[model samples]
Structures are given as structure tokens and as C-alpha cells.
Target: MADDSHLRETPLSRTELLRGHFLHVVRDTVRMPDGAQATREFVLHPGAVMVIGLLDDGRVVMERQFRHPMQAVMIEFPAGKLDAGEGSLACAQRELLEETGYSAREWAFAGRLAPTIAYSDEVIDIWFARGLTLGERRLDEGEFLDVFAATPAELQAWCFSGEVIDCKTLIGSMWLQNVQRGEWVLPWAASPGGADAGESGT
Candidate 1:
């Protein structure tokens, strides 16, 4: 079993299938672990970050965005794909501000989640933001979403009732549970201005 576990597939050749604005797809011929050749196709993503914004009143900021692929509105933490050469923390902060019109004075790196492991190389860095101050939302053109706050208990209820089906948010709820129960520890850093309002939500 140990010897089999060490086996790995080696890519022999790769061909670009499609390159879009944010996603790149490629097909590769690889030498399989069992000494067989196979073709694999996958999307290459720039990765992303999801921000769990916890307010002073114990509510979390969430977004209801219409996901075209799903053909439904998804209730999710404010998140976005990383911009070119952007750091994960920067992306998280930007996404929270852009999508929800809020900024946090404290930031913690909760963890990471792989949303689609079977087909795409995508990684989402999970973040917990607290000490929030309302700010004007700077959404991208054509991006439309409704932002609102929900208590942790309410969010959990939605999760159990099949209302919150987003994979990342579900995984994030697990992290929230552990963190709230003192089973997990998150190291937080002070954001610039530390709760002072330099922007307006209006």
C-alpha cells in the first residue's frame, strides 16, 4: 500500500483548449500511475478568497448573488477571484468592501477550501473579518448582488434547512462552529484605521 501511494501521473504533453478572461482550460496527455497513457482536461483558475465578516452585533455579512452557472441566487460569504498578482488578504479585503460595503478593522486567516477538486485547480482562502465599519460599495460594472447580515445561528439554520447550498459557505460554517466553540484558534491582525470610518455605506 505504501508503494502504491507513492505512484503519480506524469504529464507528457499539454494543449491549450480555451483561454477566457479569467479561466484557462487545458488538455494534457499523461502517463498514469498504472503505466497507461490518458488524457485529462481541467480548468486553470487564479484562485479566490472568501471573507466572513462578523459584525459587532454578532451578525455576519452575506451576499445573494445570481450565479449564472447554477441558474439560481446563491447565499454566500463575500468573495471574489484574485486579481493578477494580488495577495490573498488584499483580495479578501477588497471583495468584502466591494461586495458588501463593509471593511473590517481586524482580519484573521480562517483557512482554505478547495471547492471543486475533481475538475478544476481552484483554491479559496477563507478569512474572518471583524470590527467592521460600513462603507460605500465599489462593485464592478454589471455585478449585481444583495448584501445583508445574518446571525450565526440563522446562517446555520439555513444550512441545515437546505437554504444555503454553497459549498464554500457550508465549509465556512464548520470553521465558524469550531471557532465559536473554542475548538479552533484564529490569529487576527489589526487593519489600517482599526474601525474608524473613512468611507460611507451610503
Candidate 2:
């Protein structure tokens, strides 16, 4: 099948714009293939990174924090917006430690997700961290959160029962489960989890 033959371009024209704080806003006029036109507003944002930290005992670390936009506290995987010129893996390491006060000797890039593609341009890289140790949590000035660890079953229950409402966290948990069952493998897993599989503080 020559799928390219069916492709049709959507002509666009800029109508408005704004730029600030890692976001670029633009209102674009698009002409559909059917000859109709519409204006779409979009925000371009720098991507982010998230971590699914797993303990040696197979427990997963999560955090509970208040999301101002949703006006509710939610349990989510530790994550942060990518700093300018920062590598995804580095951002993942920094976020995990800052949010949970923990670091891992082993790290693996799991996957990526675009949480809101229709209106926002943001990609979130997911990671799996193991060989854990505790460290000083260098949280941003306005950040506040509480951390907890849960087994696979507990995590699933939390997701299905509405305790964990963050989409990214749920996706990260599912990915970790698949990886643990050997359905997925980390990009870099030389020795995998070994006898020294548990929690530690830095």
C-alpha cells in the first residue's frame, strides 16, 4: 500500500502569539482538506522527564502532592520539566532525588509519552531506577511533596480505585510491571537487579 498518496497537507497561517517561561503560544489558522478552515491555539513547551524508582524488593516509589491546576492532591511518579540544555537521563536522576530524597546506582530509559498533544507540545521521558540509596532532597523553593513506596499489587489497586489519578504515573507503573515480568527490557541492564536489591539513603 502506498500510504503516502493519501496524505494531504493542512495549510496554516499564524494569527496570534506569545512567548514566555519555557512556553511559546501561537494561534494558527488551518485550512482543512475539505476546504474548511479553523483557528487553533497551541502551546509549545520543553519536554520533561519522569522516573519509576523500584526497590530491590520490587516496590515502586511514588509521591503525593497538590496540583494547583487540578486543585487536588494526587499521587504521581517523580518528574520535572527538563532544564535548558539538560540531558534526559540527568534530568531523571535529578528529579528522582529531589522529589524522593533517593538515588539509584542503576538507571534505565523506559519510554516516552506525550500527555497532551492536541494543545500542548511536550514529551515526557520515562526511566527506571534501581540499586537505590537515600540522599539530600534539593527541592525547588516552592515545591512540597510526600513520598511513599508501594508493591505492584498496591500500585494497581491505587490506579484502578482512583487513588492515583496522574496519567504519567499510571503509565510508568504499567511499564515497570511489564519490564519486571520480562515482557520489556531496559535499554541498559548489564547485570539487572541482584542480591543487593533494596533501599538505601545517601
Candidate 3:
């Protein structure tokens, strides 16, 4: 097996552009594998957090909200953008409570995903939230959503029925299912006898 410590990583030189309401543009100069050079444009983001909140009975909590860009209501896991200087786990807890009126006793980092790589540098941090307990929901001033819980089969049906259309939610739900089935593990949680690579559900 290849020595994990010897793997090469991408190195880039970047310049920041427009920094506005939760968005920033960055220009990157990267070295090509063929000993060439190239420039890549990326929208630097603060990243995001998603919660796969599993209830005590094994159902997963989900939210239905209208996405302005898609112009449609979609079922999605509770999620929110990371505030500047906020931790991903913290964001997960906040979003879960605010959007679904639920809090979990156990939280684990499931994995990360890049929803859009072609035009943005966004890395979404996914977390698994279990041992859930109901609480008072606190929605944002203009936010509106309907919350529900579903089993794996129900969620799958919703996905195929066009009820759950958000890419991130679909990926997070599948990741949660695989994790529960022992088919996935976080890189940091891997041991000598476990999978050592990071798995991307995207």
C-alpha cells in the first residue's frame, strides 16, 4: 500500500476579490501536473454545516423549504452556512435546533462535500446527529420550513418521487445510511483495521 503520509496535496497561490453578503471571489494560480501553470477562479466560501438528525426510533429529521434558486419546495436535512469564525459542529447544532426543533446528545463528523466545484470553493461539512430530543424551534426572521421525520425507505421514496431534490440533503442522507450500515467511516476515526481514506458521498 502507498504510504499515506507521502501523498501529494494541491498547492495554490490565491488573490481575493469581491467580499460581500456571504460570498467572496478568489483567483488562484496553480501548477499543472505536466510542469505547466494555470489560473483557476474560485468563489472562496466560509463553508457550511448539515445535520442528519436521527431520532430515537431511527427516523431521520428533515425539513421542507422553498429554495429561491430552484423556485421549488424541497425536502432537505437541516443545514446552514458557517458564520465567520464559527466551528462546523457548532453550526450543525444551531441549525438542527433552529430548523427542526430538535437537539442531539451525540454528534459526529460524517464527512465533507463540495456541492459546486466548477465555480466555487465551497466545502460543506456534514455531521451525524443522534439521540435526538425535541425543543423549541427558532427560525430566522424570514425563514420558513416544515419539518418531518422519515425512515430510510421513506426517504428513498421521497428522493425518487422528487420530494427531496436538494443535492446536499440527498448526499447527507445516503452517507448517514451507509455509516449506519458500517460501510463508511471518517478518516480521523479510522484505525489500523479500518478504512483509512475519506469517503465523499457527493
Candidate 4:
């Protein structure tokens, strides 16, 4: 089937709005599809990764941390932004260990997600880890969060009750449900630091 045509906006000018420690904001003036000029603002973000740390007894490792911008504490999977030149799988493994103190012998590249496509260029790679061993967390200096585990049923209830409202985690829960029910399949591979299999979209 042929897809409908897309509307392409042409950039007339762009101005650097702000450059912060992690976020780079920009404003662009563009010629819209209908030929009217308008300004659009957005942030450029370094990509990140999230890990669904599955244990042997059907629980998932997770975290609770406060986000200043949201003015609320959020429940999330073990996740972090990429360093200057980190691979997605490497970042996922590093973040999982750093935040939760667990390492896996088996890993799967579940998918990627754009949590906020309307105003930011942010992509989060999602991964699943199993065959677990636990150790001390190696959190970054100044980072503070509590790590815990929850059953899939508990997570689903949290989502339905508005307790867990993070977009990425909700997507993770969907993936968990589908995979557990044999409706979705993931390509499993050796743990991180080994050769990474290519990622697929959910």
C-alpha cells in the first residue's frame, strides 16, 4: 500500500536559544507546508537507554527518583543518558549495574522509544536482562535513587492506578505483557560487553 504524502517544512533560519549542561535548545523559523512562516522550539538531547532487569522468580528491578522539573518522584526502569561515545547496549548495561547493582548473563534488545517527540529529539533504547547476579550499586556522584523490584501484576496495577506514570516504563510494561504472553518475541543474546545484536522497534 502506498502511504499518504508527508508535509515537509523548510527551515528559513535557526537561532541558538540556550545550551545547558545536558539540553541544547533551539528555535527555528520555518516555511510551513501551506507556505506560512512560523517558529518552532525544541531541545536536542543525548540519547539514553532503559533496562528491564528480570529476575529468576518473575520480578523486575526498578528505581524511584525525584525529577526536579516535574516536581515529583517517579518510578522507572534502570536508565541513563549516553556518554560522549557510548553504544546503546553498553550504556544499558552500565546504567543497569550502576543504578541497580545487577548484571545479567543473557540480554535482549527489546526496542527503542521516543518518549517526547513533539518537543525534543530524545530516543531511549530499551533492553531486557536475565540470568542475574546482584552486587553493590555504582551510582554516579550526586545521584540518589532507591532501587527495588516488583512483579508484573503490581506494575500493571500501578500504571492503572496512576502510581507509575512514566511513559517509558509504561511502554516497558506493555512489552513485558506481550513477551510473557508469547505475543511478542525478542532476540536474546549474550550479556553486554559481548557482541551486540542489532536492535528492533516495538
Candidate 4 Cα outliers beyond 4 Å, as residue runs: 1-6, 192-202
Regions of model 1 farther than 4 Å from truth: 1-6, 192-202
lDDT of candidate 2 over 1-202, digit per residue (tens):
6676335547478855888765689888877666788887988778899888888888988888999889999999899998778778767777777788887778788889998888988899998888778766778888899998888889889888988879898888789778878999887653223312212211
Would you estimate the TM-scores of all the predictions?
A: 0.92, 0.85, 0.77, 0.91
lDDT tens readout by residue for model 3, 121-174? 789999886766786787988899999888988988877887777889889868
Each prediction's Cα lDDT score? 0.87, 0.79, 0.76, 0.86
Give the CA lDDT, 0 to 100, for residue 136 in model 2.
Answer: 69
lDDT score of residue 123 within candidate 2: 91
Give stretches of model 2 more than 4 Å off. 1-11, 15-17, 20-23, 189-202
Q: Comparing 2 and 4 by lDDT, which wins?
A: 4
lDDT score of residue 183 within candidate 2: 99
Better structure of 1 and 2 per lDDT: 1
Top TM-score prediction, candidate number: 1
- Which clashing pairs does model 1 show? 136-200
Query: How far off is residue 180 in model 4, in Å?
Result: 0.5
Arranged by TM-score, best first = 1, 4, 2, 3
Local lDDT at 57 for model 2: 85
For model 3, the stretches where C-alpha displacement exceeds 4 angstroms are 1-17, 29-38, 185-202
Error of 3 at 96 (Å): 0.9
Count backbone clashes in candidate 2: 5
